[model samples]
Target: MFLHLGGSTVISLKGVIGIFDYSLTKTNHVNNYFNNGKKIIKICEDDEFKSFIITNKEIYLSPIAANTLKKRINSQNFTEKVNILQEHPTFK
Candidate 1:
């Protein structure tokens, strides 16, 4: 499953697992809207921005990539990273 978190970035939940065990359990108890599976691709950390691009189905930023994306997000530069991803083609 994919989600659009307002910006141009995207998140893919397929086969992905939650970082915290409690979150996983809590999420599983909720009424799933997508019914895609037991996975969460979208997350928001304190003091950080979160966004997604549903069309591409990829997670753009997390705490791991926050440092790199901070300046870009501040400048509203989204497509540059997407373009870089397309050009390099790393993970699925």
Candidate 2:
């Protein structure tokens, strides 16, 4: 599973730790954490900040909303449940 983080940055969903909405929080700590140029991958086409994804590898600044990203991630679970149901004799 891969999540498209706006630009050409598509990362493995398995590696993602969390998806956060930038608008909801006023955490200067998080902003400070991204300082020093560790690697802030900007995927937002507009200057507007949307959400951010934290991974084991890097932090991503995405144009997609947190809710949207969450849906994408949870879609994996929905697919798995559908597959399980399909495999059951009762479902068949």
Candidate 3:
């Protein structure tokens, strides 16, 4: 499954480590350290960033809210599970 961060940015869900509220970065030193040297790909055009997505290979700054992104992930999980169940012999 793939998750859309915003704009044209779509990432593989398998590689995603976490999705976090951008505001947390303001107070978290660990987040600050990650931002110091890593290349952050901003998905939105404007400077307003509501969330950040941490993946296996890259970090993304997204304009979409963290809750929205989380919902998307949850929905994907639900759909995938349904598909798997439908493919089972018992479902046939």
- The C-alpha TM-scores of every prediction are 0.21, 0.69, 0.73
Instruction: Assess each prediction's global lDDT (C-alpha) against the native.
Output: 0.31, 0.63, 0.69
Against the true structure, candidate 3 reaches a TM-score of 0.73
Model 2 over residues 1-92: C-alpha lDDT tens digits?
A: 77777768788776676677765334555656667466667776546668877777787878877777767767666333111110223212
Please, what are the lDDT tens digits per residue for candidate 3 over residues 1-92? 88888898898877777777776665555456576766678887656888877777777889988878878878776343211110223212
The runs of at least 3 residues in candidate 1 whose Cα sits more than 4 Å from the true structure, single-residue gaps closed, are 19-46, 50-92
Report the alpha-carbon TM-score of model 2 versus the true structure.
0.69
Model 1 root mean square deviation, Cα atoms? 13.6
Candidate with the larger lDDT of 1 and 3: 3
Which residue pairs collide in model 3, if any? none
Q: Show how many residue pairs clash in every candidate, following the order shown.
A: 5, 0, 0
| TM-score leader | 3
Name the regions of candidate 2 deviating beyond 4 angstroms. Answer: 78-92
> Where does the lowest 10-residue lDDT sum fall in candidate 1?
83-92
